[model samples]
Target: MSIATLSATPPPPSSRAARRTGRLFALTGAFVGVVYGYDTGSISGALVFLSRDFHLTEVEKGLVNSILVCGSIVGALIGGKLADALGRKAAMLIVAGSYAVFVALSALAPNVVVLDLVRFLLGVAIGISIVAAPLYVAESTPARIRGASVAAYQVATVAGIVITYFVNWGLSGGGHWRWMLGLSALPAALVLIPLLRLPDTPRWYVLKGRTERAVEVMAMTDPDVDPRAEVAAVSAALAEESGGSARSLLRKPYARAAFFVVGLGFFCQITGINAVTYYSPQIFEEMGFTGDGQNFLLPSFVQLASLAATVLAILVIDRLGRRVVLLCGIGTMVMMLAVLTAVFGTGELSGATTWIGFGAILLFTAAFNFGFGSLIWVYASEAFPAQLRSTGASVMLTADLVANLLIAQFFPSLMAWAGAARTFAGLAALALAALVFASATAPETKGRQLEEIQGYWRNGGRWPVAPEPREVSPGPLSPTGPAGCAERGA
Candidate 1:
C-alpha cells in the first residue's frame, strides 16, 4: 500500500487466486449497475400508481421522470474530476452510498415535487457512478477479457431492469409504487460492503505517482503478465501528460476519441431507449394491453429480451469486435422502429394486431442490448489516453444524459401531441443517422491494451498495433473466437 516501495507487501498469490480477486474487483465496482437499472426502470411501473396517488397531469409526469436527468448532468460535470482526485474505488463508494440514501428519500417523498427533488438527487448519484464504474472496470481487468469485464456493468444494468420488471408485476395488484422505489435501497447498501474491500485501480495509482502500488495491483488483477512491465508502460505513457482537464480533451490528438465517445453516447440516448425504459407500460396501454397487470407483465418480457441480448453481447464483444456489434445493433433498431412507425401511422394496430408492435419492440430491445447498451461502456473506458479518460467519459455521459433528459421530460407530451407513429419515425431517423455515424467513426478496441489504444488516436487515428506474442499460440479461449485473441503486446 506504500507509495514509495513494496517493502511491506507480502508475496503475490497463486495465479488462480489472483485472477479470482481480479474478477471480484471488476464485478464489485460494476455492482453500481443495479442502481442504474433498478432506479430508472422502477419509475416506469411506479409512475403508473404514483401518478394516480399524486393527481399528476401529463406535464407533471414528464417533470417527474426528467428531473433526475437534470441532476445527472450536474453530477456528470463533477464526476470526472472527483474520480481523478479521489481515485476510482473511493469515488464508487461515495456514489453507492448516495444511491442508498437518496433513493430511500425518493420512496418516502410527501408530494410530486418532493419526489422529483429526491429522484434528482438520486440521479446525481447515478450520474457519478456512470462515470466511475466503467473506468474502474477497464482499469482493473486485463485486455483479453476487457470487453466482457466492462460489459459486466451493462449486464448488471439489464439484469437489474429485468428484476425490477418482475418486482413491478408483483406489486401491480397492490399498486405499491413506494415499495418498488424503496426496494432499490437494499441492493445499493449491500454493494457498498464489497466495494469497500476492493483496491483502487492500478491506473489511478499510476496517475498519482504510486507506481509500486500500481505494480502490486497489476499482479493481482492480471496474473497472465508481468506486473512491473505493465506498470512501467503505463508510467511511460503518463510521463509527459498533464492533468485530465476538460480543456485538454479539445486538443487535436484527443478529438477523434472525443467525437466517437460523444456521438455514440448521444445517439444511444436520442434513439429512444429511455422513452421505452421510462414508459413501456404506458406504451403497452396505448396498444390496448390496458387496465390489467398485463401492462406490467409485458415489459418483464421486453427486459428479458434485453438481458439475454446483453449476455450474448458479453460473449462476443471481445471476439466480433466493437464496430460490428455497434453497427449491427443500431441497424436492427432502425428497421424495427420503422416497422412500428408504419404500423401505428396506418392505424392497423388493434387488439391482437397490437401483438405486432409487441414483437417489434421485443426485437428492438434485444438489438439495443446486443450492441449499443453493452459496448458503449467498453469504448468509453478505453477510447481516451489514460490522462483524460475520466474527463472524456464525463463529457460523453453528460451529452448522453442531456439527450436522456430531453427524451424523458418530453416523450409523454410528444406522445400526446405527435402520436407514437411520428415519434417512432423520428427515433428511426436518428437511429439511421446513428448507424451511419458509427460505421464511419467507431474504431476497434478488441484485445488491445489501454496503452495500445491511446496510440491509435495519437497516430492520426490509425492503429499503432503491435505484434502478438509467440507464447500465446493461435486458438480461441473461452471468449476469443477461432482467429484467437489479437496482438495484445507492444
Candidate 2:
C-alpha cells in the first residue's frame, strides 16, 4: 500500500497503555545516551586535567579529543551494515560490549597514545549506539508519539551530559579525570540488561523475512496500530527498492533524502556547538570566569539548560512540527552567534556585557537542544524508505561526524589564530548557512507515518504528497500497552 492509501483514514487517540508500551521500547533504546552523553561531555573538564598529565601540545590535545569522533565514523559505517544484518538489538549488544571494554581501557591507559587509541575504540561503541539506538526507538514506536520517542534519545544524551557536568564539577577539585572517564563504563554496560529483554525492532524482523516475529514485536510495542497494516506498510516501502547499501543512497528517490540528512547534519555541526561543548571550560576561562571551579560549575548549568529545553521540545515537537522548530532554533543561534562575535571583538566583556555573553550562550544552548539536538535524530529516522534507513542514517551520521571531526581538530587552532571574536564570526556565517539550508530543504514530518514520510521523498522531495492526518475520536486498545523513552542519541 502506498502512504496515500494507508493514511487515508485518521487514527483515533491511543490508549495510555499503548502509549506507554511504545515509549518503553524507545526509552530502552535511548539508554545508550547515558554513556554517550557522559563520554562526549566528560572530556570538556577532563581535558583540563588530562593535558596537565600528558604535557600535551595544543595539536595533541585536539587529536585526543577528535580521535574518538574518527572511531565513531568507523562505527557508524560498520554498525549500519551490521544492524541491517544481525538486527538493531544485536548491534546494540555489540556497542555495549565494546563500551564495557574500551572505556575501562581508556581509564587505565599508560600514555597519551594508549589513551587516544582506547578512546578511539570507545568512540566505536558510541558510533554504533548513535546509529542503532534512535533507529530502534523510531522503528519500535507508534507514529502518534514517534517524534517524542526519538527525541527521547536526545533527552537521554542531554541528561547524560548534565550528569557528566556535575561529575566533572565534583571531580574538578581533585582533577580526577581518570575517574571521570571510567565512570561512563557502568551506564554503557547497564544498557545490556534492558536490551536483553527487548526484542529487535519489528521492521528489522520483517526485513529479515521473519513475519511472525515482526507481528509479535509490533503487538508488544505498538499495539495502537494494527499489526497487519504495519506489516503491509513496511512491505510496501521495502518493495520500492531492495538490495540497499551506502552507495545505493546516492541513487534517485533515495538521493534527496540522503542530501537532506547529510546537509542538515553538516550545517548543524559547523555551527560550532561542539566547540562550546568540548571546550567550555577553556571558553569560560577565556570569558573571564576565574573563580574556583566556576568553569566547571557554569557549564553544568549550561548543560542543565540544554536538558530542560530538550524536555520541552519532546513535549511539543509532534505538534509544533520539525521545520518550524529547527528554523526558530537555528535563527536564534545565528543571532546569538553574530552578537557574541561582535561582543568578543570588543574585548570589553567585564560586568554587564559579561553577563550578556553568558545569556547568549544560554540561548544558544536552548536553541540547539530545542531544534538541532533532538529533531536531527527524529528527521534522520523518518527521512528514508525502509530499505535504506540504516544505511542512510549511517551515511548521515558519518557526515555529521566528519564535520564534528573538523571542528574538534581545528577549533583550538582557529581560536589561536583568529581569536574568539573572529572564530565566532566564522561560526555565525555557518549558522546563517544552516538557517538558510534548513529553511530551503527541511520538510515537516510531524504527524506522518513512517511509510508516508518515505512517500514524501518518492514524490519528488515535497511534503503533503497525501492528505494531512486528522485527530479523531478515541478507540478501544489494550490497557496493558506501554510507550517509549527519550534518547540525543546518537
The most accurate candidate by lDDT is 1
Whole-model lDDT for model 2 versus the true structure?
0.81
Q: Mind giving the per-residue lDDT tens digits that candidate 2 earns over 276-392? A: 889888887777678638889988888889888888887777789988888988999999998788778778568777777887888898899888987786787788765676567
Give the TM-score comparing model 2 with the true structure, all chains together. Answer: 0.83
TM-score leader: 1
**lDDT, residue 70, model 1:** 91
Model 1: which ten-residue window has the lowest total lDDT?
481-490
Candidate 2 regions with alpha-carbon error over 4 angstroms: 1-24, 141-147, 219-241, 245-257, 381-383, 444-490
Model 1: number of backbone collisions:
0
Please report how far candidate 2 places residue 61 from its true position, in Å.
1.1
Scored by Cα lDDT, where does model 1 land? 0.84
lDDT of 2 at 423: 92
TM-scores for every predicted model:
0.85, 0.83
